[model samples]
Target: MTNTHQRPLRILLAKLGMDTHTVGITIIAHALREAGMEVIFTGLKQTPEMVAAAAIQEDVDVVGISTLSAGHTRNLPKLARLLREAGAGDKLLLAGGVIPEEDRPLLEEAGVDRTFTMGSDTRDIVAYLNEWWAQQLAADA
Candidate 1:
């Protein structure tokens, strides 16, 4: 398990593609930091390759991408594929912002670890990451 007592988990937070909404993601980054995790915020308009590259460069345990353009159905899968091809598939992929409820399963099938809709508390995101990171460490061990 994660030496829950050791170093803070590192996370990369980004706004992928043409989406420019940063309010939600900014709050999430602050929340993760408050929850004792290290967060790297990659500003807006990031391509899948850029997102994957940031994840690799930061060596984060998780990557959270925020999108509000209704492109999750199309964009997320492509991002997942790129991450896999780039050898970053082991990193957790998370999506948030304006995601339709009906699209959750499809996004999951496309390799998104979790999807957060509007109104979700930041604490929930942080808690989920903590739990997820712990589980990942346990699995690696």
Candidate 2:
């Protein structure tokens, strides 16, 4: 379901690498859509290049990645670098799903604007995007 808004925030959701976790990303995508944001979900097994390309092509405001595999250590940084290299460093880079608490700092350092774990609520995610997008709009003004 798509929502009509003056300027609906656009987010792209991607499932990276061998991480086959679908339920979480699916639920999150639905939540974002329900919150009145436009979302483009890239199906599973996407490489960093693919994710970056999709985001650029879609002209999204945010890129949400979900990775459950241990490959996150390598994948996250590469994804960040690619996005940044493409001049998308200002775009909100969000990550979620099965990431360890210990690695949260590393992920943040690697360019993730926010990280959501298992117990996180859908409202929180929406609220964050709302605030971020609002700030961006203000800045652009």
Candidate 3:
């Protein structure tokens, strides 16, 4: 169902693997909601399979995974591969939290659409998703 007040963007926000940083994900969820998007938070320590399943079940446009435990290299790629295998690779994949600058290019190469560093504004994430949604719709058309 569409939201009348604003274009609805469904998002599944989760923490991958053993990463326990919930503060950033919580803040992002609040920001997305404030921006008129629907958000589903999957809480901490989520497996790649569970994340992909949630994204499919929820039919979310975006899947945001937070990796503060330095597992982005290992986890993000595996998650992307899993999503692809599940036929949800078209869904946007975004990551944040303690991501080092040097790893950005590698993560992008690994199919992560966007990466946010510490101190980046929440509004930036909201705007990125909105733009991404628009682009996806255009591409589909």
- The candidate scoring highest on TM-score is 2
Whole-model Cα lDDT of every candidate shown, in order: 0.84, 0.87, 0.86
The ten-residue window of minimal lDDT in model 2 covers: 1-10
* Candidate 1 residue-wise lDDT, 1-141, digit = tens: 234445679889988789898888888888888899898988888888888888888888788889898978988888888888988888889999999899999999989988989899887787787787777767766
Better of 1 and 3 by lDDT: 3
Put down candidate 2 lDDT per residue, 1-141, tens digits, no spaces: 122234889999998887998998899989999999998999989999999999999888899998777788889899999999999887789988888999989989989888898778999999999988887777665
**Model 3, residue 62: what's the lDDT?**
88
**Candidate 2 backbone collisions, by pair:** none
* Model 3: CA > 4 A from native: 1-7
- How much is the lDDT of residue 58 in candidate 1? 81
For candidate 3, list the clashing residue pairs, or say none.
Answer: none
Order by lDDT, highest first:
2, 3, 1
Q: Is candidate 2 or candidate 3 better by TM-score?
A: 2
In lDDT terms, how accurate is model 3?
0.86
Residue 33 miss distance in model 3 (angstroms): 0.4
